[model samples]
Target: MKKSSKDSVVTAAILLFNSKGYSGTSIRDIADAAKVNTATIAYYFGNKEGLLEYCFTYFFEQYINKMEASFATIEKGAAICLKRVVADLLHYQWENIQLASFVYREMSIDSQMVREIMATYSLKEKYYLQKIFERGFEWNEFRPHSIPYLIIQLKGLLMMPFMNTHYMREVLYVFPNEKFFEQKYLKDLYQWIDKTLCSDIQIKKEAIIK
Candidate 1:
């Protein structure tokens, strides 16, 4: 990648945001971590809050783009749509645990920032899953209940492992690290979700095929 001031600031911001938080991290800290002068952060990002906003946008933009690509490839019917989306999502969080942690951390501390990010992306891909769920519901694809809650529960299944790292590292000794994203886990996870929600239903798994 070409070296640039914006790249430097973003890299530093993500690292510091992962280690420190939005409030805990400062412009000086990011500058120092990036080996640039504090003025560079100000020049590039305008200020600390500006830097935080940039970091939030940077993280979720990358996420949305990646998810868009994954969903584009494997979105069709309800069952396969959920499976593929969830599988790709699991692989993404497993690969970029920092991104997920950074998002969860920021959302935990300040929900407004998270809401802003979601709102920004929602018009595009953020709320697209709701469309998928609505389509599935119309087709009698999902369980006969709150489809939104089920969708969020599926997201929770992916988020819990990463957000609760300390507990996993200490107690469960089972971390959702690199190797966990392999075909074995993803296949089983997809299968479990498939059976859990699709077994009794008549809707065929045409999402991935389509």
Candidate 2:
């Protein structure tokens, strides 16, 4: 299917943001790349900030859909669910670093933007993970700590490589764009996070202490 004008504009904005910072991206540039008039984008999205909001929503929707699909087959297995969640997160971060950078950049300084992200996508994302953890604990399958804190830690480690690609480039000689799914690279990190966050084996109601 042919891409929609709005999708084209958003993709162009992500590319622009990847090359230049957000402030450096202009509507005309997006328009030219998207092959739509600047007015077309403004009409579709209202303003640059509006275009950005759509970009955030688009990227986040894709991310969430991927996560949900990864766990779709396993409705009741907590360890499998956790593993798939981390795997989805690791894969998304590795594959979509440009979009992630756009988000992280906005989050660094724009209080309103950060609030908007939280109120919109972030809250639902957090709720999904928290529900996963709470359900895991309730089944006596895994221990539950603060779901928010565990999520923070799970998310931080998963996102750090993508967010700090420049620093990791200098320090560990880690190649961000290199084959991210190699067993020892992101996949290993995915398993390590799962092991760290979940139990060695699913336990019974008495054996497991939350």
Candidate 3:
């Protein structure tokens, strides 16, 4: 199917935003690349910031939708469910690696956009993650751990590799955009789940008592 004009604009914007930070990229640049007029961009997105917010919203909407779907379908333990959630998330991020990288980088700044995201999608993400961990603990599938910290850990794991793509490629010599990297990265996440969340702390405590 032929892409929509709006999609073309967003595509161009993401590319420009990724290479040149949001502050550096101009509306004219996006318009030139997208082959659309500035008036069209304003009509669709209002302004550059609106475009940025749309990009962020687009990413999180799909992200939360994926998580919700994964949660609804999975009936097994937390480990399995979380694996599916993270897998889905990773797949989506990798599919839009540039957007993912750009959005995450943009998040570092304190702005109204960041604040709004924290108040909205970030809370929803936390809620879903909290539910998964709660289920894990109730079912004795996860070791005792603070949910907030777990959320932080999971977020870091998900964001770090992609957000620091240049570091991964240049410094670490690991190519995050590669199929092999995805497999290796997923393997590492599974190991983290196994060792951290799935470990039987109760058993260890009882053994220590004995």
The estimated TM-scores of all candidates read 0.79, 0.78, 0.92
Each prediction's whole-model lDDT (CA): 0.70, 0.73, 0.89
Whichever of 1 and 3 has more TM-score, that candidate is 3
**Residue 112, model 1: Cα distance from true site in angstroms:** 3.9
Q: Order of all candidates by lDDT, from best down to worst? A: 3, 2, 1
Q: Which ten residues in a row have the lowest lDDT in candidate 2?
A: 200-209
When sorted by TM-score, best at the front, the candidate numbers are 3, 1, 2
Candidate 3, residues 1-210: lDDT per residue as tens digits?
A: 988889999999999998888889999999999999999999999999899989999998998899999898556767779999989999888888999999899889999989999899999999989999998898787888999999999999999988989899899999889988888899999888878888576346435757
Which pairs of residues have clashing backbones in candidate 2?
none
Model 2, residue 101: what's the lDDT?
69
Question: C-alpha displacement of 167 in model 1, angstroms?
Answer: 2.5
Model 2 per-residue lDDT tens digits across residues 1-210: 999988788889888977877789899999999999999898899999888877777778887887777667457576667777777776676677778767766766757767877887787778677777877777655655777788887777667777767777899888776664333565666555455655545633224545
**Clash pairs, model 1 backbone:** 76-207, 77-207
Q: In angstroms, give how far residue 207 of model 1 lies from its true place.
A: 15
Candidate 1 on 1-210: residue-level lDDT in tens? 777977877877777887777678887888888889988888887898888787668767876776676566434565566666777777777777766777766766647777776678745654657666666667777665565676577667767777866676789777667595355567777765666566345344445445
Please list the residue runs of candidate 1 whose C-alpha ends up more than 4 Å from where it truly belongs after superposition.
Answer: 1-3, 70-75, 122-126, 181-185, 201-210
| Maximum-lDDT candidate | 3
- Candidate 1, overall lDDT? 0.70
